[model samples]
Target: MLFKDQVDFVRQHIKKNKLRVFMTILAATMGCAFLIVLASIGFGIQDTMRKEILEDQVITEVEVYTNDGEALDISKISAVEHVNAIVQRTRMDVMTVSQLENRSLEGNMALTNFAEEQKSNLKLSEGRMPTKDNEIIVGYQFAENLLTDAERNQMEQNIEEEAEPIGGYKESLIGKTVTMSLQSYESDEAFPENWNFTIVGVTEKPAKDWIVDTNILLDDSWKDKFQEVYNASVEGENPDLFYSSSKIYTSSLEHVKSVTEELKGMGYSVYSVSEQLEQLDVFFMAFKIGLIFVGTIAVLIASIGIFNTMTMAVTERTREIGVMKAIGASPKLIQRLFLMESAWIGIIGTVLAVIISYVVSFLANWILPMIVGAALGEDSFEELSMTFSLIPWQLVVIASVISISVAMISGWRPARKATKIDVIQALRQEL
Candidate 1:
């Protein structure tokens, strides 16, 4: 028989038992949808984590660590191929008190090279880079945390009472000369000489909302002057024990791997965000495969329904099969018709399953964040970019192939049974 005739034959039989076919398709739909939605959780979480890592770190930046106690040679690192810039920061161990008018704040002080910082595209919220050794740049939250003694006391009291704390200094810190006093770590006594620096700029805010950037960045030229006071305060301490952190930036993200390898070859320990992402991808790939394996079990369970339905169809159409055989229809043609009907059921069910999966994914992504935020008693989570469920095209294709293949396999035994039906017994209505 022609393919069109075979299709018509299958359609007529399916129409005769509409309710049974509908239920079979429903089972298939539920199975396929479950698989997609279950595996989507893995995909969604992987995507969210990948995005967070990318946002929190500079992909092209490689952190260089010295293997020995010696400091990193900036000149040698800068000479490497594809190297864009190098930013080295030396943190002062002494307690630094920054005083602006009547308000003062104790914060971390780091000496850095302004030239290298400019090359690394260090962002500023206001004003320009420092042009003199006495000029410095502060973090975005520097002004906010610079509070007076009375305000600090009030803030402490409010914290104890679980009340909203008073605000900090509202005035702009740009072009302001701030007095910095280094205090001895062993004693509360301030050093005899105080260093005065002009605030030329405020660094850009951090990527995370919860991170407070209150660090102060001074010119490397002032490192010696600050070190002298720090060394004098701690007479027996070794200044060489203090290590500086150096970060190397590549011209582009594509060059990070090569640059990192070269730095490692030079006997320096290097870490890059790209390396972290590579590990993350490998982990998620295996995790997603496991989730898919678990989800396939649901589809297999649904296949049982397909098998039963097809078997019933063969039994019900035994007489019809005998009549077709008596009229010269081949066994293979009969089998093909049965298989086609099962495939049709799979096709319809898979299409519907994809639609349902997408709807569920959207709803989950939307509702889950709000639900979690409410449970945590924090509204900031609602603003976070998080994915709870995701369905990519590749997942849909995998599910379709699995669903349709299982349906065909389920119908195979029943289709073979139809081909072996005894024409004489079926025609006579006898065993």
Candidate 2:
């Protein structure tokens, strides 16, 4: 028979048992929808986590660490390909007390190269970079941490009571002159000479909300002056220990891998956010596969219904099958007709399921964040772009293939049984 005739034959049979076919299709739809929605959770979470990781740090920046007691070779690192700029910082070993008017606070002091910092894209919230030896840049939270003696005592009390500390210097600190007094760790005495610094700018805020940046950045020229005081305060101290951190920035994100590999090969420890993301992708890939596997079980269960429906169809049309055979219809043609009916059910059900899954995913992404934020009593969560369910085109294709393939397999046995019906016996049966 022609393909059109076979399709019409299947359509007539389906119309005869419209209610039964509808329910079968509904079952298949539910199975496919369940699989897509379930697997989407895995995809959504992986995407959310990946975004969070990328936001936490610069992808093109690599942190280099020294091995053993060795010092990092800046000249060698600068010579590497795609290396745009490098920022090196040396932290003062002795605790320094910063005083501004009646307010005083102990702040971390680090000497850094301003020229390299400019090349590394160091941002400032206000003012310009320091040029003179006495000029310096402060962290975003530096002014906030500068408090009077009474305010400091109150802050400590609040901390003890597990309450958020409030009240800090709110005025702009631009062009303010502050005095820093270094305290000797060994003798527990303050250095007689105090260094005065003019605040030229404030560094940009950190990426994470929880992070508090209050570091004081001075010119690398001060390193000699600070080192002399530090050496005088302590005996037999390794100078290399003062070199706190070194970071290398690539010209583009694509160069991060090459720069990191070269640094590693030169016997230096290097870390970058891009490397962490690579590991994260591998882990989530396996996790998503497992979810898809579990969801496929639902489609398999739905296939059982298809198998039963096709078997009943074969039994009900036994006389028709015999009549077609008595004429000139081949066994393969009869079987094909049955298979086509099952495939139609799959196609219709899968299309409907995909539409439903997208609607559900949209609702989930929209409503879940608000619900979570309300439950946690934190409105900040609602402000964040958090995805709860995500369905990609790849997922739709996978679901369609599985649903349709299962339907065909389920109908195969029943289609074969229809070909084996005895024409003589079927002809004698009641129509």
Candidate 3:
């Protein structure tokens, strides 16, 4: 048969049974729309999660922490293939004070810029990282906390103690001297007020919540001062002094294994980012699976609609089928005709669904920003660009396959019934 003639015949059949055809198209359209929307949502969620996870630094770098032991042999770790550099970091909690105002501050203490030969992975979003001893760089959260009314009042009380109530110096403290004290942890209950530091730079807050709180950067040149201040706080008592720790980094998984081996040889425990990343992957997979399971139910309902519509179409076309068979149309030809009609419903419905879904995605992308901004107390949603990104090839294949499969399943029984119809009985049935 000619393609145009077959299409015309299909159109004529549909036109004669307008209600049935409309219902079939509606079912297919609903199914396709649901699938496309759910898939887009899944992709968006995964993309957002990945961006958040990798925001701070590259996940490829292994995070190593030090507890209590001999330092891992750098030479042995360096010998591992793909090993590039190792950076050691140490941290402690200390009292910070405004040197200009002489009031104690609250923050975590960090010492870095350790060895001149070592490469650093530390990044500064504002002022430079501290290179000199006593030159502190505060994160954004620290700066905001320092500016609060409670802290400002506490600083003023110190001024009252010294009889140097300098209101003029309050503004100067931003760029002026800030001191940090290194005190004994054991004697903290008896003599809690004894460590100090000098502040130099303040920068953007770290993205990770844990890293921003109680963070103060320092250098190694002030170890003597740290010890001296620590001793004074203990008042000749052999209280436990604050200790420092180091973290070593490697370039690759091979390097991490090498470093782990060397650390084991040195009688130390070690960990790597590979384990953390593997856990993260498992988490994402479970999350995606759960979403798909839920979304599948909605798609299943849509498929039921397809089945119902096809069944109705067969019942409505009983007379037409009987006439075709009476004219010597073979059962195979009759079955093919029903299948083609069902296929047409699937194809046209999917095309409509694709167009409608794009419109829906576009509107969501535009409106969601305003809603998010209001919820987050932000002026704009510039940070959160809600993308309506579709996996085009995957979507295309999924939609096409789903549409055709749904059509076939819905038409199967109807096609078989149409083929089995007795022409005499069908013609006699006016009802």
Candidate 4:
């Protein structure tokens, strides 16, 4: 028989056994869907993790702190290869007046110049950066404490009316002046609560694992005011008027190592997430392996269905097979025909699986956010519901392997059984 004739015969057999074909196709579809969903979720999680590591330009920069007199010389450090620039700023955990307490609360605040560092890293949910010396931008938690401090101070002084809060939350601190106590670090005793600054901006709380809170972003003008305070304490002599740390930004791994060593020698501590970031790459590798393991089980079940259907088809066509052998048909030809039927089933299963997987991925994209929103509230869900992208190559490879292997295994036993049939016995049995 011609190859085309064998293919046509397999197609006819599948058409005749419509129910069996449907079941096998359904199995293949489910298997594809499983593989696709797992792959999508794995890649989605990796993307989200990458955002946390790379977005906002967080990982590209390293912050170096110095409390001792060991802070590096900025000019010497800048000469390192691939070191683009360094942003220098100081942070001190000082008291900000808590209006709720009417007394100063122990709060740590960051005093940074908004001009040097990238703005995106400092997330501004509302308001704008401080443009003047007296104005300051604070974190979400710090803003809340400032507002509470205002209310408490008002009550303490027998003042009945305080400014009406716009939305009844800490978010109302925008565009208002709040009191925070600034004292010199040299003084062991608490300084008077006299310093006050306007709330020009409110930034999102620092990242979850951030080191400081109740932070402040101040322009050059505010730094001058801090300088004045320090100078006064030191009897008009320069006492390093402003205390600051420097951050180096770079993309080259070689430069990172070199600069880190140089900075370390200059009495500065080197800080980066290089180790933690590498863990994410390891996680995705393991995840893809695990998904393939699960996919293998689905393929095994489909193989059994293929074997049973082929075996049954062989039994029903026993008399037809005997007549063919009586007409000088070779056993090899019969085996080839059975294998062709199995291959066709494999092809059908694979096509169905790919179609179903595409549909499922679309539905998941539409429905996942709604479900998350209902469970976690709209605001929280908004942050969590990022885009989902599919892995096409993974889908194609997995689907093809699963479908073809199942069919080949299923067709093998029936082909062997057909080869053992005696033409005389098969011809006399039923027909």
- Against the reference, the lDDT scores of all candidates come to 0.89, 0.89, 0.62, 0.68
> For candidate 3, lDDT tens digit of each residue in 104-201?
44556665653421343455555555555556666555544454455577657967787543222233223456644443343444334443445555
Give per-residue CA lDDT, model 4, range 11-52, as digits (tens): 888788899878876775566556666676677677777776
Of candidate 2, the 10-residue stretch with the lowest lDDT total is 234-243
Model 4 misplaced regions, further than 4 Å: 1-3, 38-59, 63-69, 72-82, 96-115, 118-181, 184-214, 219-228, 231-246, 251-274, 319-336, 358-383, 386-393, 416-429
Per-residue lDDT of 143 in model 1: 92
lDDT of model number 3: 0.62
Best by TM-score: 1
Segments in model 2 whose C-alpha atoms lie over 4 Å from true places? 1-8, 185-188, 232-241, 370-385, 422-424
**TM-score (C-alpha) between model 4 and the true structure:** 0.66
Candidate 1, 1-431: lDDT as tens digits: 88788888889989999999999999999999998999999999999999999888777799988866677887888899999999998886677889999999888888999999998888899999989999999999999898998999999999999999786889888889999998757688888789899999999888888899999998888877777766775667555524589999999989999999999899888899989989999999999999889888988998999999999999988888899999999999989988998899898889999999999999998988999999999897878899999899999999999999988999999999999999998898744
Clashing pairs in 4: 89-245, 93-108, 97-180, 98-149, 99-149, 99-150, 100-148, 100-149
Candidates ranked by TM-score: 1, 2, 3, 4
Estimated TM-score for each candidate: 0.91, 0.88, 0.68, 0.66
